[model samples]
Target: MIYYLFQWLDDFGVPGARLMDYITFRSGCALVLSLFIAVIFGRKIIDRLQMMQVGEIIRDLGLEGQMKKTGTPTMGGVIIIIAILVPCLLVGNIGNVYMALMLIATLWLGVLGGLDDYIKVHRHDKDGLKGKFKIVGQIGLGLMVGLTMVFSPDIVMRENVEMRNVENSEVVIEYVQEDVKTPQTTIPFVKNNNFDYSWLTSWMGRGATAGGWILFVLVVIFVVTATSNGANLTDGLDGLATGTSAIIGTALAIMAYLGANIIYSSYLNIMYIPGSEELVVYMAAFIGALVGFLWYNAYPAQVFMGDTGSLTIGGIIAVFAILIRKELLLPILCAIFFVEDLSVIIQVAYFKITKKRYGEGRRVFKMTPLHHHFQKQGGIVTALIQKPMQAIPESKIVTRFWIVGIMLAVITFVTLKIR
Candidate 1:
């Protein structure tokens, strides 16, 4: 690991060894290194996948440009996984609990996804691994993350309590006291952004605080499942998941930086998470990896990420937000993914409900997953609610969604200062 080597070199009077001391410098280095790895090695990985005949099994969706993607390589998520792990191992503090947790999450979900992809490609099952197994894996991951946060000594938060009064009955809150492990997370746009799960367990009386861990674990499970599924649904088009994930990663990087800085955390009246700054280094690597992978993934994708990248991306985002105590912001930051997930649920539920009453199945959108709905041909006789006058090109749809993701990222950060 470069970090330890440089750290030891400092004792030997090695010049510029101090660069590792700065989070900014280390993060920048991580970005560059990861980007280089993703782009340079992406081609080789794609070739290997091609040699192995690991290609995507495209289902007929009848959308424009759909067949063109037939036989394109899938499971390119290896590129991202390698890019992130290498940089973090070389430049990051491996001993930091947060870093360790992130590494585990990345690899854990990545392996699960890789397994699913393997089943699909080798076993010739388009359905891949059973749905129950995937849920079990996600639940397992959530359990690990939840229990780790509850029990880890290094995991803790600084509470922000109101300190002074301001105009219009507003009070400026200031964070105080030593960091202690708690089930508290930031809730945006509220005066005191901190929300503790123990409050929900007030019925426990004097022991309510202890019961908060139980409540928090449930919330972690829900967050992990929802966000990961949301991301998985969003990986439908070229550059859609990769580009949107890069945006989310960038916003998360800012949150990690601010949450770890005592001055910024106190000034913003947010919980201070010690050692979370290391997450910035990881996020930079994540962003770089996604962007570099996009070089080959955008428009007519040369390779697909399959569940390998999609599931890992989602899991990483969920875990990173949890570590920074900003999991509550996920709905706002990952709104696009949420909408995509919701569209399918809504459409399916509506169709089933209507079919029971009308003796025939109905539809909600031209197609589900939200993205395909936009690409569907505008026809008067279609089974669903069709609002768009005409079909949009796939490229335009992806770009527009990206623009929305960018907007959400900005607004997510803005909400912190808005209060």
Candidate 2:
């Protein structure tokens, strides 16, 4: 809204209105405005949730201070959704395909998460929407994003390189061609960062292009489902999901900037995605909304994000990575979420296997989700790799995880330069 107004004013020779032409400037303004909205409206939203009794249903897992969090307001992701949408609508280019996709992703997952949270709260079922239902919703979103990227003429990239005509010893840096379809993505620790999906389908010979798109869609579905589930698992502690997501958002913002800029794209030897610069504005709002929500979401929380916030955050992170052609980097950047998810899987599988073998159920961790494992009861517990048997404080655990998230963010960036 404000962006269009300023853009029109700039055409009319209005002084300083041209500042809107710069992505950095608009992104900065979006950051500030989103922060203002989150801080200003957050309290009121919390109050409204309380009035509606949209409280978290806690199960006693024997972790320290676990019961205290019961009834804390959940589904606070609405705050983040509003903050992001408002800023993007005001400052982002409404016509940009990337912006359109991001907005759809934010709202789509938000509604799914909101429905899950609603079921948990009103139906008094801790297991909100059925697992199959959640998976279906994630698959739906992934398909939408994949089809859009494939079919939308606006969503295209140009491969850039410094071409050398060896006969004359002349070199020129240029984009290969106009926007066209390809399954190219960035791979860390490689001289040529761009990796094409068609290479994986080389067996298809002349039909490799079709096979590559199929593989790409499958990859998108997996990423969206896995990341969203990982985030939901990481929401075990106060401020854990919100804080970690903010860090990831900041990293994605930098990636989007580099991927969208022709000069940087050429320098980095990556795909140049025209109009993707608009994503920087979206990411700026994401970071701001998470930080501002943290004002009340910090330790000794005033509200919880519930599935609404957690799923939405994960979806945004996943889609952002996909858009920037950095989906491969997610394993490193989102290691914490993966660890949390894996811990539960390992624990559950171990328990079931042991029970089948010994005719008695055995445990792997005192609790699952990895974080809660650190917040367990002190006792003899049969588990693998239980060196740190001593219980750790929740606040300390959250802080340490945050530090890890930061370290991962740094390494994620450094990997691009490392190769």
Candidate 3:
């Protein structure tokens, strides 16, 4: 709203109104405004949740201080959602396709997660929404994002072509004259970062392009579902998911800015995604919201994000990466979420196989969701790799995970130069 107002004022020759024309300026403003909203309004929301008895239902997991968090307010993700949406609406160019997609993703996941949390808290069903139902919701969101990308004419990219300056002995890259829609994405450690999904359907010949899009849509569905669930699972410890998401959001913001800029896209030899710079403003708000939420979400958490925040955060990251053609980098950039997700899968599969073979259930980790595994004391469960005899402090664990997340973000950015 403020953005449009500034635009109108700029038309009338207002001196400072033109500042909104710069992505950096608008993004900065969005960041500050989001932070202000989250911090200032967060306490009141938390108070309301407390008054309504919207506390978490904790099962005794036997980890240190586990029971202490039982009554902490849950579903505090509403604060984050409001903070993020308000700033974006005020400062973001909502007309941009990428911005519109991001806003859709936020609301879609927010509602889905809010429903899940509502069931768990209000209905007193610890299982919350049925697993199948959650999966269905995720699939529905994936389809929405995937189909939009396929059909939206505004979403297009220019392929960067490299040329040799024979006389000057320098290499130069140039963007094509026309923007083309393709299922190409950035892949790390390759001289040419472009990886076209069409390559998988080359046997189709004339129909290969269409087949590639179908495959791309499937990939989008899978990525969105997996990452969103990964985040939900990683929300085991205070600030673990929130801090890591903020880091990931920062990296995505940088990627969006560079991909949208013609000069940077050419220099980096990456796809030039026209009009993607608007995503920087959206992401700036995202980062601010998470950080502000962290004010209460950190150690000795005052409020829990529940599914409301985790699912939305993951969906945002996935969609943002897809928009900037950087989804291929998520495995590395989002390694923490992936590892947390994989730990649960491994533990479950190992337990099932062992039980079938030995007639008794065995385990891999003391608990699932890797973060909780570190918080468990050694020798308590039959598991592999239990060398850490003492449980690590929750605060320490979150900090270490955050450090790892930071390292991953840095490495992700370096890949642009390495390629």
Candidate 4:
């Protein structure tokens, strides 16, 4: 609302209002406003949650300092959600298609996650909302995002292609003159990094474009599901998900800025997405929200974000990447989340396989989710190199994981040129 008001004032010759015309300025305001909101208002929300008795139900997992977290306020994700939404509403271009998509995603997933957290706390269901319903919500958002990206006229991209300058006889990277809608994304370690989704359906000849879009929708669903689940699993430690998410959000903000700017896109030899600058504003809010939340979420935590924060942040990351055509790079940028996801799958699958073959279930990691494996004191009999035989302090584990997350973020950025 404030953005539109300022934008209109700029047309009326208002001096300071014109500053909103610059994305960088608006994004900075959004960051400061969101951080301020989360830090200042976050305590009140946590207090309200405590009054409501929305405390976490700690399951005794035998990890270091595990049970001590009981009775701490959960559902603190509401602070993050409010922080992001308020800043975006005030400082972002609400009419931009990219902005609209992000806001809808924030609300949609926020509600879904809020319900799950509500169930866990109020209803005393550790399982929370049913898995099927959660998946349905995620898939619905995926379909909505996929359809909007395909049909929205404002959502378009100019392809980067190499051209020879006739006068100089030199090859240079340049974007095509006109923007087009397509299921194309950036891939790493290739001479020309663009990979068109239609290639997956090239066998269909003239129908390839349509088929490719269908495939893209399915891919969106898969990415949303996997990323959300990964983040959910990674929420095991204090400040783990919050700090790591802030790091990834920072990297994403950079990408969104570069892709939306024609000059930067050309210089980087990457696709130019015309309307994606709004995503930078959104990501700034995301980072601010996380960092401020981390104030309470750090070790000896004052509050837990519960499912509400985990699922929403994960979905946001996935959608932001999709909008900027960087979904393929998620494996590298979001390696920590996915690794946590894989640890559980590996542990469960291996246990089942061993039980079937040898009449006794065996383990891979001492505990699932990978992070807990570090906090756990014992090693699985079948596991390899269990030298960290004693529990590592929770704070040390979180700090090290954050360092790894930073390394992944750097690698993700380098891919813009490494390709």
Compared with the true structure, the alpha-carbon lDDT of candidate 1 equals 0.91
Candidate that scores best on TM-score: 3
lDDT of 1 by residue, 1-419 (tens): 99999999999999999899999999999999999999999999999999999999999988888998988999999999999999999999989999999999999999999999999999999999898998999999999999999999998877878765555766665666677888899998887788999999999999898898898888888888889989999999999999999999999998899889988887888888988889999999999999999999999899999999999999999999988989999999999989999999998898889889988777878898999888888674535678685889888999999999999999998888787
* TM-score of every model versus the real structure: 0.97, 0.96, 0.99, 0.98
TM-score of 3: 0.99
Model 2 lDDT, full chain set:
0.90
**RMSD (Cα, Å) of model 3:** 0.9
Query: How many pairs of residues collide in each model?
Result: 0, 0, 0, 0
lDDT of 3 by residue, 1-419 (tens): 88999999999999999999999999999899999999999999999999999999999989999999998999999999999999999998998888999999999999999999999999999999888888898899888888898899999999988888999989999888998999999999889779999999999999998999999999999999999999999999999999999999999998899999999888889999988899999999999999999999999999999999999999899988988889889999999999999998999999899999999878888888999888989995678868577899999999999999999999998888895
Clashing pairs in 4: none
Model 3 has a clash total of 0
Q: Once superposed on the true structure, which residue ranges of model 3 sit more than 4 Å away at CA?
A: none
lDDT tens per residue, model 4, 1-419: 88999979988998898888899999999999999999999999999999999999999988777999999999998999999999999989889999999999989999999999999999999999999999999999999999998898999999999898999999788888888988999997786898999999999999999999999999998999899889999999999999999999999999999999999888888899998999999999999999999999999899999989999999999999999999999999999999999999988999899999999888888888999989888766776437589989999999999999999999887877875
- How accurate locally is residue 359 in candidate 1, as Cα lDDT from 0 to 100? 80
| RMSD (Å) per prediction | 1.8, 1.9, 0.9, 1.2
Candidate lDDT values, in order: 0.91, 0.90, 0.92, 0.92
Residue 16 of model 4, lDDT score: 96
